[model samples]
Target: MADRLRSIAFAIFFYGLSVPIVLGTPVAALLGTSFMRGYCIAWARLGVWSARHILGIRMRVEGQRAAGPALYPAKHQAMLETMAIAAMLDAPAIVMKRELARIPLWGWAARRYGVIVVDRAANARALRQMMREAQAALGEGRSVLIFPEGTRVAPGETPPVRSGFAGLYRALALPVVPIALDSGQVWPRRGPKRPGTVTFRFGAPIAPGLARADIEARVHAGINALEP
Candidate 1:
């Protein structure tokens, strides 16, 4: 109960503090998109700091952060990994649902930051658009991060990855860096966050041109290392 309260308080505090920064995202965009992107990354770090001091939730990354741009398909267990990964990576273009890119302030900031928004209902067209956006990001030397599962699942659950992940792999022809984490054990999809260290284990980059089945199987094994 105490930890829950602390977690809630930290969220409120962080949101309150970020309101001004989020509001000014457009202004920063006018100067350069990197301004807002850097701010957002810094904001993610702040959230991590609050999680540690206020909620007693720590982070333990098991592998070295990817140095250059690559296609990153990560486990989707909780929001904690989202924040932590964004903070740890360099010039990341996070692929997300279109709905999130519609929220007023955040949406504006995301656009300026070059976040790749996908319309899941649009099928192949969406994949094509995402491929274009992802290629553009990679061309700019930025890492592209996608949650292959499309949505969050419980820590022990493993859902079939959306086909869009394969689309990116096929289109970009870039090595896929699969990352696994147990963030859901600490920060769940719905519920109070528990206090613990979230571990993100990054697997070796898989060369491009593998069959879809093989890529999916390898990614599944890599991301589910934490599953019992």
Candidate 2:
């Protein structure tokens, strides 16, 4: 119960901070400058700090950052990583579901600040389109972030890694930076939240020249080492 309260309080606090970030991005954009991008990332990192200090959730990051301007393929455990890393890493252009673009203010805020939406329901067509968009962004020197698992897993359950991500690796041929986490235990799907420790294992970058299978293997191996 106490952890749930803490979670609620922290959520409220971050929501309070997010309002300013949403407003600031546009205000800055109106000022005829690109300052909002940095502000957006700064606000994201602050939100991450609040998750730790305010909510008592801790994150442990491992491995070295090898994918600068590369594809960041992560093991999806919860929404926390989605938000937290959006701040911790460089102003990487995000690839998320197209549905989010319909969210009230959040969609606008994220889109204006470099969020790229991929329609998950489009099946093979979605794959074809997303690659084109992702490649264009990466070519412009942006890092790509993707959840190879495709969907969130229940706590303690392992899901088959969808081939979409592997397909992405083969196509991009960019170094893969794998980030793993144990967040589901502390964060309930539809119930109260707990203040458990989560770890982000960042495997070394799969160098640009490595074989695609070898690179994907290394990424999966790193995630396998993480605790549930």
Candidate 3:
């Protein structure tokens, strides 16, 4: 109970303090995209820092991040990985839902930070748009991080990989690096915080050009390998 309260308090404090800076992202973007990236990294690290001190949750990143341009398909088991991945990757641009891009200050910041937004319900046009944006981000030397499950699930559950991930992989023709973690065991989808170390393990990059089935199978296997 006390841990939960502390987590809540820290969230409130973080968001409250971030509003002004997030709202200012547009101005920062005018100077350079690096400015916005720096701002985002700082905010994400703050969350990680607070989670450690206040919630007593530690993070351990195993294996080195793959070099060069690649698409990162990570398991989505909790909300913590979003910020954790952002802080860990180099100039990462996340692919998030379009609706989230309308959330006032956060939306503004996301745009400034060069994050790509996709309309899940839209037709072929939306897919093309997302591909274009993602390709552009990759061209800029930013790793594109996407969650193939499309939504959070329980730690042991394995949902089918969304078609969008396959589409992006085929279009970009970049290596796909699967990231696995067990954040749900600590910062569960719903419940009090549990104190423990969340491990983020980055698997080897699977080169492109393989059949979609092979890629998906590899991704699923890689992401599910969270424990020894």
Candidate 4:
């Protein structure tokens, strides 16, 4: 009961505050990407803060943070990591689905903030576009964050990464920093949130240029390293 109530309170507070930010995103965009980056980061931090205080969920991040431009293929178990990534990373260009990138005002802000939107059902052209944007982000010294599974999964489920991961890896030619987290244990894909520590374990960087099979295997193992 308490957890459910807290979850409700957290959602209300978080989304309520987001109203004004979403409305002002256009102005932020006009201020330029630099200002918008800061704006997005601030919003992400607010989410982390609310999760900690209202939902009683704490974050425990392990391993060293990656340096320079690299690829981050992370475990996707809950929405918490979506916000957490922005809060933790240094202005990374996160890869998200086309649906999310189409969410009206939020989508507008995300595109302006440099998120790389991927069409899951797209063909070679979409792949090329994704790589181009990812390369541009890397050129700007920003790491590219992607959830290889493409969508959220339940705890303990280690789904094979989508094919696009390998294509992007090959195209970008950057080291891969796999991230494993147990956010689903606390903040699930459905139902009320629970109160527990969400652990994000960052694996060591896998060097670029590995064969498609090898890279896929390594990332699959790395991102599921924390699963029981």
Clash counts per candidate, in order, are: 0, 0, 0, 0
Candidate maximizing lDDT = 4
TM-score of each: 0.95, 0.84, 0.93, 0.98
- Give the 10-residue window scoring lowest on summed lDDT in candidate 4: 61-70
Q: Write the per-residue lDDT of candidate 3 for residues 79-165, one digit (tens) a residue.
A: 789888998896598999988999977887788788888887868989999999998998898899998888888888988888888
How does each model score on lDDT?
0.83, 0.73, 0.85, 0.91
Model 2 Cα displacement at 164 (Å)? 2.6
Candidate 2: residue 197 Cα off by (Å) = 2.7
Worst 10 contiguous positions by lDDT, candidate 2: 28-37
Instruction: Write one digit per residue (lDDT tens) for candidate 4, span 1-228.
Output: 898899999989999998998899899889989999999988888899999999999999899667778899999988789889877886799998999989988888899999998998989899899999998998899999999998899998988989999999999999999999999999887889998999999899999999999999999999999998
Off by over 4 Å in 4: none
**Candidate 1: stretches off by over 4 Å:** none
Q: 189 in model 4: Cα distance from truth in Å? A: 1.8
CA-RMSD of model 4: 0.8
RMSD of each: 1.3, 2.7, 1.7, 0.8
Q: What lDDT, from 0 to 1, does candidate 2 have?
A: 0.73
